[model samples]
Target: MSPARAATSVVDVVAAALRERILDGDLPPGERLVEGALAADHDVARHTVRAALRVLAAERLVVVEPHRGARVAALEAGDVTALYELRTALEVEAAHLALSRHEGRLPPAVHEAAASLAARCRVGDPRWVRVSEAHTDLHAAIVRASGARRIIEAHGALAQETRLFLLRIRPHLGYARLASEHEELVADLERVGPRALRAHLRASAAVLVDQLA
Candidate 1:
Protein backbone atom coordinates (compact mmCIF):
# COMPACT_ATOMS: atom_id res chain seq x y z
CA MET A 1 0.00 0.00 0.00
CA SER A 2 1.04 3.59 -0.58
CA PRO A 3 2.09 5.93 2.25
CA ALA A 4 -1.33 7.61 2.19
CA ARG A 5 -3.09 4.24 2.32
CA ALA A 6 -0.98 3.12 5.26
CA ALA A 7 -1.67 6.34 7.15
CA THR A 8 -5.40 6.03 6.44
CA SER A 9 -5.43 2.46 7.71
CA VAL A 10 -3.68 3.44 10.91
CA VAL A 11 -6.11 6.27 11.43
CA ASP A 12 -9.07 3.99 10.80
CA VAL A 13 -7.79 1.46 13.32
CA VAL A 14 -7.29 4.13 15.97
CA ALA A 15 -10.67 5.65 15.24
CA ALA A 16 -12.52 2.34 15.44
CA ALA A 17 -11.01 1.42 18.79
CA LEU A 18 -11.70 4.82 20.25
CA ARG A 19 -15.24 4.78 18.88
CA GLU A 20 -15.88 1.38 20.45
CA ARG A 21 -14.63 2.55 23.83
CA ILE A 22 -16.78 5.64 23.57
CA LEU A 23 -19.90 3.70 22.63
CA ASP A 24 -19.21 0.95 25.16
CA GLY A 25 -18.79 3.42 28.03
CA ASP A 26 -15.20 2.47 28.70
CA LEU A 27 -14.59 6.09 27.84
CA PRO A 28 -17.60 7.54 29.58
CA PRO A 29 -19.00 11.00 29.05
CA GLY A 30 -16.79 13.75 30.49
CA GLU A 31 -13.87 11.32 30.84
CA ARG A 32 -10.55 12.82 29.85
CA LEU A 33 -8.61 11.25 26.99
CA VAL A 34 -4.86 11.19 27.40
CA GLU A 35 -3.26 11.16 23.96
CA GLY A 36 -0.09 9.31 24.89
CA ALA A 37 -2.03 6.78 26.95
CA LEU A 38 -4.43 6.10 24.12
CA ALA A 39 -1.52 5.82 21.67
CA ALA A 40 0.15 3.25 23.92
CA ASP A 41 -3.10 1.32 24.36
CA HIS A 42 -3.81 1.25 20.63
CA ASP A 43 -0.16 0.59 19.72
CA VAL A 44 -0.18 3.66 17.50
CA ALA A 45 1.70 6.94 17.48
CA ARG A 46 0.47 10.03 19.27
CA HIS A 47 -0.08 11.74 15.93
CA THR A 48 -2.27 8.91 14.78
CA VAL A 49 -4.20 8.98 18.02
CA ARG A 50 -4.74 12.69 17.69
CA ALA A 51 -5.99 12.25 14.13
CA ALA A 52 -8.47 9.61 15.26
CA LEU A 53 -9.71 11.72 18.17
CA ARG A 54 -10.23 14.61 15.79
CA VAL A 55 -12.52 12.47 13.67
CA LEU A 56 -14.56 11.52 16.75
CA ALA A 57 -14.63 15.13 17.87
CA ALA A 58 -16.08 16.05 14.51
CA GLU A 59 -18.71 13.35 15.05
CA ARG A 60 -19.51 14.96 18.44
CA LEU A 61 -18.43 11.77 20.17
CA VAL A 62 -15.65 13.67 21.89
CA VAL A 63 -15.18 17.28 22.89
CA VAL A 64 -11.73 18.48 21.86
CA GLU A 65 -10.03 21.31 23.65
CA PRO A 66 -7.03 23.08 22.12
CA HIS A 67 -3.93 22.97 24.35
CA ARG A 68 -5.98 20.93 26.82
CA GLY A 69 -7.30 17.52 25.70
CA ALA A 70 -10.41 15.71 24.57
CA ARG A 71 -13.23 14.25 26.66
CA VAL A 72 -16.23 12.05 25.87
CA ALA A 73 -19.42 13.79 24.81
CA ALA A 74 -22.34 13.76 27.20
CA LEU A 75 -25.90 13.09 26.18
CA GLU A 76 -28.40 15.21 28.03
CA ALA A 77 -32.13 14.57 28.41
CA GLY A 78 -32.91 16.73 25.39
CA ASP A 79 -30.27 14.93 23.38
CA VAL A 80 -31.87 11.62 24.25
CA THR A 81 -35.25 12.88 23.15
CA ALA A 82 -33.83 14.14 19.87
CA LEU A 83 -32.12 10.84 19.19
CA TYR A 84 -35.34 8.90 19.81
CA GLU A 85 -37.31 11.30 17.62
CA LEU A 86 -34.98 10.70 14.72
CA ARG A 87 -35.00 6.97 15.41
CA THR A 88 -38.78 6.90 15.45
CA ALA A 89 -39.16 8.70 12.13
CA LEU A 90 -36.46 6.92 10.16
CA GLU A 91 -37.08 3.42 11.54
CA VAL A 92 -40.82 3.63 11.04
CA GLU A 93 -40.27 4.92 7.52
CA ALA A 94 -37.84 2.12 6.80
CA ALA A 95 -40.23 -0.52 8.14
CA HIS A 96 -43.05 0.85 5.99
CA LEU A 97 -40.94 0.97 2.86
CA ALA A 98 -39.41 -2.46 3.45
CA LEU A 99 -42.78 -4.13 3.98
CA SER A 100 -44.11 -2.48 0.83
CA ARG A 101 -41.05 -3.67 -1.13
CA HIS A 102 -41.47 -7.23 0.10
CA GLU A 103 -43.48 -8.82 -2.70
CA GLY A 104 -45.14 -11.61 -0.75
CA ARG A 105 -43.02 -12.80 2.18
CA LEU A 106 -40.00 -11.62 4.11
CA PRO A 107 -36.58 -12.42 2.65
CA PRO A 108 -34.73 -15.43 4.05
CA ALA A 109 -31.93 -13.62 5.89
CA VAL A 110 -34.36 -11.14 7.39
CA HIS A 111 -36.70 -13.89 8.48
CA GLU A 112 -33.80 -15.75 10.02
CA ALA A 113 -32.46 -12.68 11.80
CA ALA A 114 -35.92 -11.97 13.15
CA ALA A 115 -36.22 -15.54 14.38
CA SER A 116 -32.82 -15.27 16.03
CA LEU A 117 -34.05 -12.17 17.82
CA ALA A 118 -37.00 -14.18 19.14
CA ALA A 119 -34.69 -16.92 20.30
CA ARG A 120 -32.43 -14.36 21.96
CA CYS A 121 -35.41 -13.08 23.93
CA ARG A 122 -36.33 -16.58 25.13
CA VAL A 123 -32.79 -17.23 26.40
CA GLY A 124 -32.48 -13.92 28.33
CA ASP A 125 -28.92 -12.70 27.93
CA PRO A 126 -27.35 -10.67 30.74
CA ARG A 127 -24.51 -9.34 28.62
CA TRP A 128 -25.18 -5.83 27.37
CA VAL A 129 -22.81 -6.21 24.44
CA ARG A 130 -24.66 -9.30 23.20
CA VAL A 131 -27.99 -7.57 23.63
CA SER A 132 -26.78 -4.51 21.71
CA GLU A 133 -25.54 -6.50 18.72
CA ALA A 134 -28.91 -8.18 18.39
CA HIS A 135 -30.76 -4.86 18.66
CA THR A 136 -28.48 -3.15 16.14
CA ASP A 137 -28.75 -5.94 13.57
CA LEU A 138 -32.51 -6.09 13.77
CA HIS A 139 -32.83 -2.36 13.10
CA ALA A 140 -30.23 -2.56 10.35
CA ALA A 141 -32.13 -5.38 8.68
CA ILE A 142 -35.34 -3.36 8.69
CA VAL A 143 -33.66 -0.28 7.21
CA ARG A 144 -31.62 -2.19 4.62
CA ALA A 145 -34.73 -3.96 3.42
CA SER A 146 -36.18 -0.59 2.45
CA GLY A 147 -33.43 0.11 -0.09
CA ALA A 148 -33.71 3.80 0.79
CA ARG A 149 -30.44 5.73 0.75
CA ARG A 150 -31.18 8.81 2.84
CA ILE A 151 -33.34 6.87 5.26
CA ILE A 152 -30.53 4.41 5.86
CA GLU A 153 -28.12 7.27 6.56
CA ALA A 154 -30.51 8.80 9.04
CA HIS A 155 -31.01 5.46 10.73
CA GLY A 156 -27.24 4.97 10.96
CA ALA A 157 -26.77 8.30 12.70
CA LEU A 158 -29.53 7.53 15.17
CA ALA A 159 -27.98 4.15 15.90
CA GLN A 160 -24.68 5.79 16.75
CA GLU A 161 -26.38 8.17 19.17
CA THR A 162 -28.43 5.35 20.63
CA ARG A 163 -25.27 3.40 21.36
CA LEU A 164 -24.06 6.20 23.65
CA PHE A 165 -27.19 6.12 25.78
CA LEU A 166 -27.19 2.35 25.73
CA LEU A 167 -23.75 2.50 27.27
CA ARG A 168 -25.42 3.88 30.39
CA ILE A 169 -28.77 2.12 30.28
CA ARG A 170 -28.13 -1.43 29.09
CA PRO A 171 -26.72 -2.88 32.31
CA HIS A 172 -29.87 -1.90 34.11
CA LEU A 173 -32.38 -2.56 31.32
CA GLY A 174 -31.57 -6.24 30.77
CA TYR A 175 -32.90 -8.17 27.71
CA ALA A 176 -36.47 -9.15 28.44
CA ARG A 177 -39.09 -6.70 27.14
CA LEU A 178 -36.77 -5.88 24.26
CA ALA A 179 -36.73 -9.51 23.19
CA SER A 180 -40.50 -9.80 23.38
CA GLU A 181 -40.72 -6.56 21.40
CA HIS A 182 -38.59 -8.06 18.68
CA GLU A 183 -40.84 -11.10 18.51
CA GLU A 184 -43.86 -8.82 18.35
CA LEU A 185 -42.29 -6.78 15.58
CA VAL A 186 -41.57 -9.92 13.59
CA ALA A 187 -45.11 -11.16 14.11
CA ASP A 188 -46.54 -7.79 13.10
CA LEU A 189 -44.49 -7.76 9.93
CA GLU A 190 -45.74 -11.22 9.14
CA ARG A 191 -49.42 -10.57 9.83
CA VAL A 192 -50.16 -6.90 9.17
CA GLY A 193 -48.89 -4.65 6.40
CA PRO A 194 -46.34 -1.85 6.64
CA ARG A 195 -48.88 0.38 8.33
CA ALA A 196 -49.09 -1.83 11.39
CA LEU A 197 -45.33 -2.29 11.39
CA ARG A 198 -44.91 1.47 11.33
CA ALA A 199 -47.26 1.81 14.27
CA HIS A 200 -45.36 -0.84 16.15
CA LEU A 201 -42.03 0.82 15.42
CA ARG A 202 -43.35 4.16 16.58
CA ALA A 203 -44.60 2.63 19.81
CA SER A 204 -41.24 0.99 20.33
CA ALA A 205 -39.50 4.32 19.87
CA ALA A 206 -41.88 5.83 22.35
CA VAL A 207 -40.72 3.29 24.93
CA LEU A 208 -37.13 4.42 24.48
CA VAL A 209 -38.17 8.03 24.80
CA ASP A 210 -39.94 7.15 28.03
CA GLN A 211 -36.79 5.45 29.21
CA LEU A 212 -34.96 8.71 28.67
CA ALA A 213 -37.65 10.58 30.58
Candidate 2:
Protein backbone atom coordinates (compact mmCIF):
# COMPACT_ATOMS: atom_id res chain seq x y z
CA MET A 1 0.00 0.00 0.00
CA SER A 2 1.04 3.60 -0.58
CA PRO A 3 2.64 5.45 2.33
CA ALA A 4 -0.24 7.95 2.36
CA ARG A 5 -2.79 5.14 2.44
CA ALA A 6 -0.89 3.44 5.26
CA ALA A 7 -0.91 6.67 7.27
CA THR A 8 -4.60 7.19 6.63
CA SER A 9 -5.29 3.65 7.78
CA VAL A 10 -3.54 4.27 11.08
CA VAL A 11 -5.49 7.47 11.61
CA ASP A 12 -8.79 5.80 10.85
CA VAL A 13 -8.04 2.84 13.13
CA VAL A 14 -7.18 5.04 16.10
CA ALA A 15 -10.13 7.36 15.53
CA ALA A 16 -12.54 4.42 15.35
CA ALA A 17 -11.22 2.76 18.48
CA LEU A 18 -11.52 6.00 20.42
CA ARG A 19 -14.97 6.67 18.94
CA GLU A 20 -16.35 3.34 20.20
CA ARG A 21 -14.91 3.83 23.67
CA ILE A 22 -16.33 7.35 23.91
CA LEU A 23 -19.73 6.24 22.70
CA ASP A 24 -20.04 3.35 25.17
CA GLY A 25 -18.99 5.62 28.04
CA ASP A 26 -15.61 3.96 28.46
CA LEU A 27 -14.12 7.40 27.93
CA PRO A 28 -16.66 9.50 29.74
CA PRO A 29 -17.10 13.19 29.10
CA GLY A 30 -14.57 15.47 30.82
CA GLU A 31 -12.19 12.53 31.35
CA ARG A 32 -8.59 13.46 30.68
CA LEU A 33 -6.85 11.69 27.79
CA VAL A 34 -3.18 10.80 28.10
CA GLU A 35 -1.67 10.68 24.63
CA GLY A 36 1.36 8.55 25.50
CA ALA A 37 -0.77 6.08 27.40
CA LEU A 38 -3.24 5.85 24.54
CA ALA A 39 -0.33 5.31 22.15
CA ALA A 40 0.93 2.47 24.31
CA ASP A 41 -2.56 0.94 24.54
CA HIS A 42 -3.18 1.15 20.78
CA ASP A 43 0.34 0.17 19.75
CA VAL A 44 0.82 3.39 17.87
CA ALA A 45 3.43 6.10 18.16
CA ARG A 46 2.63 9.22 20.21
CA HIS A 47 2.49 11.30 17.04
CA THR A 48 -0.02 8.88 15.51
CA VAL A 49 -2.12 9.14 18.67
CA ARG A 50 -2.02 12.95 18.52
CA ALA A 51 -2.94 12.82 14.83
CA ALA A 52 -5.93 10.64 15.57
CA LEU A 53 -6.98 12.96 18.40
CA ARG A 54 -6.71 15.93 16.04
CA VAL A 55 -9.25 14.25 13.78
CA LEU A 56 -11.64 13.73 16.70
CA ALA A 57 -11.09 17.25 17.97
CA ALA A 58 -11.90 18.57 14.53
CA GLU A 59 -15.09 16.53 14.67
CA ARG A 60 -15.83 18.01 18.14
CA LEU A 61 -15.80 14.54 19.72
CA VAL A 62 -12.94 15.61 21.98
CA VAL A 63 -11.72 18.98 23.12
CA VAL A 64 -8.10 20.07 23.11
CA GLU A 65 -7.21 22.32 25.99
CA PRO A 66 -4.34 24.79 25.77
CA HIS A 67 -1.78 23.25 28.13
CA ARG A 68 -3.90 20.60 29.82
CA GLY A 69 -4.05 18.77 26.49
CA ALA A 70 -7.05 16.79 25.21
CA ARG A 71 -10.03 15.34 27.01
CA VAL A 72 -13.38 13.87 26.05
CA ALA A 73 -15.66 16.68 24.95
CA ALA A 74 -17.67 18.07 27.82
CA LEU A 75 -21.36 17.35 27.43
CA GLU A 76 -23.28 20.59 27.36
CA ALA A 77 -26.99 21.13 26.92
CA GLY A 78 -26.71 23.69 24.15
CA ASP A 79 -24.25 21.62 22.20
CA VAL A 80 -26.43 18.56 22.55
CA THR A 81 -29.50 20.47 21.32
CA ALA A 82 -27.65 21.83 18.35
CA LEU A 83 -26.33 18.43 17.30
CA TYR A 84 -29.65 16.66 17.69
CA GLU A 85 -31.48 19.40 15.84
CA LEU A 86 -29.08 19.10 12.96
CA ARG A 87 -29.51 15.34 12.95
CA THR A 88 -33.28 15.63 13.01
CA ALA A 89 -33.29 18.03 10.09
CA LEU A 90 -30.94 15.92 7.97
CA GLU A 91 -32.69 12.67 8.81
CA VAL A 92 -36.17 14.01 8.24
CA GLU A 93 -35.19 15.16 4.79
CA ALA A 94 -33.46 11.87 4.11
CA ALA A 95 -36.53 9.92 5.15
CA HIS A 96 -38.82 11.99 3.00
CA LEU A 97 -36.48 11.69 0.03
CA ALA A 98 -36.07 7.96 0.52
CA LEU A 99 -39.80 7.44 0.44
CA SER A 100 -40.22 9.56 -2.67
CA ARG A 101 -37.40 7.80 -4.51
CA HIS A 102 -37.62 4.22 -3.37
CA GLU A 103 -40.50 1.87 -3.97
CA GLY A 104 -41.11 0.14 -0.61
CA ARG A 105 -39.81 -1.73 2.46
CA LEU A 106 -37.43 -1.16 5.38
CA PRO A 107 -34.12 -2.92 4.73
CA PRO A 108 -34.34 -6.31 6.51
CA ALA A 109 -31.05 -5.97 8.33
CA VAL A 110 -32.00 -2.51 9.48
CA HIS A 111 -35.36 -3.76 10.68
CA GLU A 112 -33.74 -6.65 12.51
CA ALA A 113 -31.21 -4.36 14.12
CA ALA A 114 -33.92 -2.01 15.27
CA ALA A 115 -35.92 -4.94 16.62
CA SER A 116 -32.92 -6.26 18.53
CA LEU A 117 -32.29 -2.88 20.07
CA ALA A 118 -35.92 -2.49 21.03
CA ALA A 119 -35.74 -5.68 23.08
CA ARG A 120 -32.47 -4.71 24.77
CA CYS A 121 -33.86 -1.28 25.60
CA ARG A 122 -36.01 -2.91 28.27
CA VAL A 123 -33.01 -4.19 30.18
CA GLY A 124 -30.35 -2.78 32.54
CA ASP A 125 -28.03 0.20 32.11
CA PRO A 126 -25.40 -1.80 30.27
CA ARG A 127 -28.06 -3.22 28.01
CA TRP A 128 -29.54 0.23 27.57
CA VAL A 129 -26.09 1.47 26.63
CA ARG A 130 -25.77 -1.19 23.93
CA VAL A 131 -29.29 -0.48 22.76
CA SER A 132 -28.42 3.21 22.46
CA GLU A 133 -25.71 2.20 20.00
CA ALA A 134 -28.13 0.19 17.89
CA HIS A 135 -30.57 3.05 18.01
CA THR A 136 -27.97 5.44 16.57
CA ASP A 137 -27.00 2.93 13.89
CA LEU A 138 -30.58 2.28 12.88
CA HIS A 139 -31.37 5.96 12.40
CA ALA A 140 -28.08 6.48 10.62
CA ALA A 141 -28.78 3.55 8.27
CA ILE A 142 -32.05 5.17 7.27
CA VAL A 143 -30.14 8.34 6.46
CA ARG A 144 -27.50 6.38 4.53
CA ALA A 145 -30.13 4.80 2.31
CA SER A 146 -30.85 8.28 1.02
CA GLY A 147 -27.63 7.92 -0.98
CA ALA A 148 -26.50 11.31 0.20
CA ARG A 149 -22.98 10.93 1.50
CA ARG A 150 -22.67 14.52 2.69
CA ILE A 151 -25.87 14.35 4.66
CA ILE A 152 -24.87 10.97 6.05
CA GLU A 153 -21.51 12.30 7.22
CA ALA A 154 -23.07 15.38 8.78
CA HIS A 155 -25.66 13.36 10.64
CA GLY A 156 -23.08 10.78 11.61
CA ALA A 157 -21.08 13.35 13.55
CA LEU A 158 -24.24 14.66 15.13
CA ALA A 159 -25.10 11.12 16.19
CA GLN A 160 -21.75 10.83 17.93
CA GLU A 161 -22.29 14.13 19.71
CA THR A 162 -25.73 13.06 20.87
CA ARG A 163 -24.22 9.90 22.32
CA LEU A 164 -22.09 12.09 24.57
CA PHE A 165 -25.14 13.60 26.22
CA LEU A 166 -26.79 10.23 26.64
CA LEU A 167 -23.68 8.88 28.33
CA ARG A 168 -22.83 11.88 30.52
CA ILE A 169 -26.32 12.44 31.79
CA ARG A 170 -27.72 8.92 31.53
CA PRO A 171 -30.95 10.82 30.91
CA HIS A 172 -34.20 9.26 32.00
CA LEU A 173 -34.91 8.02 28.49
CA GLY A 174 -35.45 4.56 29.96
CA TYR A 175 -36.52 1.53 27.95
CA ALA A 176 -40.18 1.91 27.15
CA ARG A 177 -39.84 5.34 25.59
CA LEU A 178 -36.79 4.40 23.60
CA ALA A 179 -38.20 1.13 22.27
CA SER A 180 -41.61 2.61 21.61
CA GLU A 181 -40.07 5.56 19.80
CA HIS A 182 -38.01 3.34 17.51
CA GLU A 183 -40.99 1.11 16.85
CA GLU A 184 -43.10 4.17 16.12
CA LEU A 185 -40.42 5.63 13.90
CA VAL A 186 -40.27 2.41 11.90
CA ALA A 187 -44.03 2.09 11.82
CA ASP A 188 -44.37 5.70 10.73
CA LEU A 189 -41.78 5.13 8.06
CA GLU A 190 -43.89 2.22 6.89
CA ARG A 191 -47.20 4.04 7.04
CA VAL A 192 -48.16 7.69 6.35
CA GLY A 193 -45.01 7.97 4.25
CA PRO A 194 -42.51 10.83 4.42
CA ARG A 195 -44.62 13.32 6.29
CA ALA A 196 -45.07 11.02 9.23
CA LEU A 197 -41.40 10.22 9.18
CA ARG A 198 -40.43 13.85 9.33
CA ALA A 199 -42.91 14.54 12.08
CA HIS A 200 -41.54 11.70 14.10
CA LEU A 201 -38.01 12.94 13.60
CA ARG A 202 -38.96 16.38 14.85
CA ALA A 203 -40.79 14.92 17.82
CA SER A 204 -37.87 12.72 18.71
CA ALA A 205 -35.52 15.66 18.68
CA ALA A 206 -37.81 17.63 20.92
CA VAL A 207 -38.01 14.70 23.31
CA LEU A 208 -34.23 14.61 23.52
CA VAL A 209 -34.02 18.30 24.29
CA ASP A 210 -36.75 17.99 26.89
CA GLN A 211 -35.01 15.08 28.55
CA LEU A 212 -31.85 17.09 28.84
CA ALA A 213 -33.75 20.01 30.34
Question: Quick one: best TM-score, which candidate?
Answer: 1
In angstroms, what RMSD does candidate 2 have relative to the true structure?
Answer: 3.3
Candidate 2 residue-wise lDDT, 99-124, digit = tens: 66667556665577778777788665
Misplaced by over 4 Å in model 1 are 103-105, 116-127, 192-213
The TM-score measured for candidate 2 stands at 0.77
| TM-score to native of every candidate shown | 0.80, 0.77
Find the candidate with the highest lDDT and give its number: 2
Candidate 1 residue pairs in clash (backbone atoms < 3 Å):
none
Per-residue C-alpha lDDT of model 1 across residues 50-89, encoded as one tens digit per residue: 9998888867688899888998988766776666667777
Worst 10 residues of 1 by lDDT: 124-133
